[model samples]
Target: MKDIITNIIFWVVGAIVLTVEFTFKFNDTLGWLLTTIGVILIGIGFIYKSKKPFKYLIEFFINFF
Candidate 1:
């Protein structure tokens, strides 16, 4: 119950921040960057939930870099 409530609160706060970003003439670039990061996080969460091996992917990138 506590976890669910916390998750709901977090989502609400995130939504409010995004809303403020749009309503006020703040830094658009920073807002876009935040949105992009949020998208990446969602994708990663999906991949992790699906049991995909992400460690190998990270290792491959590390090797390339």
Candidate 2:
């Protein structure tokens, strides 16, 4: 149940990102960056059993934003 929720969340987020990337006339660099980050997130979720290390990226993004 938890895994299903996790994958769903990842998929939804990825889809939203791709939609934004394709819909906007924004920076190509930023679009590719979003796609890469989304792929990395899906990879990490598939490859790992735990979600502990995500805090690092989350914190980084928080600071980045």
lDDT of 1 at 23: 76
Off by over 4 Å in 2: 44-65
TM-score of each: 0.44, 0.54
Put down candidate 2 lDDT per residue, 8-64, tens digits, no spaces. Answer: 677677667777767883577897898787777665554344556577557757998
lDDT tens digits by residue: candidate 1, 1-65:
65445545555555666566567636768878666555454444434433344875576569989
After superposing candidate 1 on the true structure, give the runs of residues whose Cα lies further than 4 Å from its correct spot. Answer: 25-28, 34-65
Which residue pairs of candidate 2 clash? Answer: none
Best by lDDT: 2
Best by TM-score: 2
Assess candidate 2 and give its TM-score to the true structure: 0.54
